[model samples]
Target: MNKLAYALLTCIVILSLSTSCEKDSIRVPVQTIELSASSFTLATDSVRIVVAQLSPNNTTDTNITWTSSNQQVAIVDQSGNVKGISPGTTLISATSPDGKISASCEVDVIKWTLHKGGLGFVEEGINAMALDKEGNIWICGQNVIKLGSQGAWLMNNSNLNPSAITFDNQGFAWIGSGSGLYRYDGSKWEVFTTENSGLKDNSIITLATDNTGRVIASHFNRESLLGTGASEFDGNSWKYYSSANGLVYDNVISMAIDKSGVRWFVTTNGISSFDGEKWKSYGASNVGVAHIGLVHSVAVDSNNNKWFGTNSGLIKFDGTKWESFTNQNSGMIGGSVTAIAFDNNKNLWVATGAGLAHFDGVKWKVFDRYNHPVQDIRTILTTPDGKIYIGTGLGLLIASLRD
Candidate 1:
């Protein structure tokens, strides 16, 4: 009787131990892994957090490792966070600890910063933009906006509507308004008009700073029958020029100083060049163009080639020859070119009535509402830090370029 009881107890204990060992050895392996996003775009220095999901809720080995296909364009941390390094495309992946189950996302790293109408800007359009000595950007439309590291702030300049703005080498900002010309030295502001200065008229339409630190302002009165030419301020004295003097036209629209220190004044129907002592003129009949009055902006490239932005198209005068680029002849998206600027890579960026075009001297890329949120580009400017600022009717578009 004792032997039978002992044998039964031993069998019961052995069965219990076998059942417990079998239950503890059972496990559920990961079958599938998926990411939240399939693809997305990010700007340089920007970050995006991604999420990974596993097929089984009670996965035994849920550990994952995040990695980037191209670390130069983007990087991924162990927490599934991706940061853009430059402009390119990279694949971000989340893999299981055993490298069997994985999921991925295509990340397009672009150097683009878009500021919509009411986000950072007070208005919809930016008529002019200038960069100060401290690398701050100043824009004028309905109000004067200064954008820096601290963000954007409005400047109270007597509630004047600025038409043009320029910053001198001495860090002073000169703004031209319809009523008068104003100057600000970071802390103080001074205005000059027909009643106080040697300006021929009270309305100033354009402003530019020469290499010698002289501020040049052009007056274009909409109420008057004709324009009042331009004025030059050499920090202490003022000099006036008009049709009665040596200027080719009294209605100056824009001015540009070439690399050789020659000042070029562009009017509605003519182009004037002054080399400090002599003045030369080029009109529609002389330049072989149909209508020179369509010219709206002028830019000088690194090679000293003069490029003109006109309503009809873009014109280039390379000293001895002239060339034209229009929608019918080139890949330009629009026929009316509003603004033109050259970047550090010598890429010509043109803002037109329809879209924004970029010319890398070999190819052309046009961006519009289909690919971007830009429309009605009014002005464009490039900074030394490889940033391109575009003022449009929608808002301000800032693009950063790497190589």
Candidate 2:
């Protein structure tokens, strides 16, 4: 009885222990999968794309499938290649069949283009511009132009031969051409030439009006005709002045009236100022103005400081001293400054033959066609809203200072 009982008991215990061990060994493998790039941005032409895959402990799992929720936007292949169809957002997902693990990434497709209201207009060019006291912009450049809150052409004469233009306090626009001066009182164009009105010369090169409603113009002399230094329109009659009347140069290119109602005439040789009483001259000999000595434009800042744009560089007269800035010294990109204007913020905007440059008392910002090239920025004006309008040989460009 003892031998048979002992053998049976030992067999039963061994069998029970073996069954428990077998049950515990039957376990399922855990699956883990992860994506490499959280987000993917691609152009609209990308075809073959590779996304990394991460597994906990299994590397031999080659059975991976990729899919996109929106096939119209993006499509994914079995080899993890993603193709972009259009500009939109789509979710790309990858799954490992063997491990039963899945991962997903967002695909974003975007397109880029040049903004017209920004610095991109530099590729074009500008010609001329005028700013009213309210900071409204009126420009005449390449194509049809306007400015500020109200985009008015300011010159709808349909005649594109205007040489120079000036605006008075009453918002009247005076345009100078080969014929004479044309006045625009926001409605129609009135022609004032040597044949009809009191214009000193028919070939008017520049125009300027004083506070006393006196219109001043400069004329260029050709062979058959005599060039007048300056002319005055006192509402009733026309008065012409030349070298015999103590004028510096007969060939006038530009003109500007200072805060004191004094007329400043710019010529190919030098600069001349005329007060109500006498005429004064300043040029190469007295004022150290260098380079070609040809004054192209002149402007008066808010502080009553006179600024001159010459073929060489820029000069500032503070009544007592003279400060000069050229391409070599200041950040002016070019020496040929064609136009100059002061904004409401007292920032000086200079239009050069090359591009546009701005000076805010301390720093200088130059905008060229390379970075944001504006071709031949003939005129620069700032609106009251701090937006800068550039008149280029191509068309009109508007830039936001807040940017």
Per TM-score, the best of the predicted structures is: 1
Q: Write the per-residue lDDT of candidate 2 for residues 278-392, one digit (tens) a residue.
A: 9888887787666537888888888888899998899998887878999899988787888898878899989787677778898676655433435556666667766666665
lDDT of 1: 0.81
Q: Pick the candidate with the highest lDDT.
A: 1
Model 2: lDDT equals 0.70
Reference-based lDDT, each prediction: 0.81, 0.70
TM-score of each: 0.70, 0.64
Candidate 1 global TM-score: 0.70
Q: Which regions of candidate 1 fall more than 4 Å away from where they truly are? A: 1-120, 400-403
For candidate 1, list the clashing residue pairs, or say none.
none
lDDT of 1 by residue, 88-201 (tens): 778999988789988898876667677776546667777888888888989888777888888887875456888889988788888899888888899988889889988777
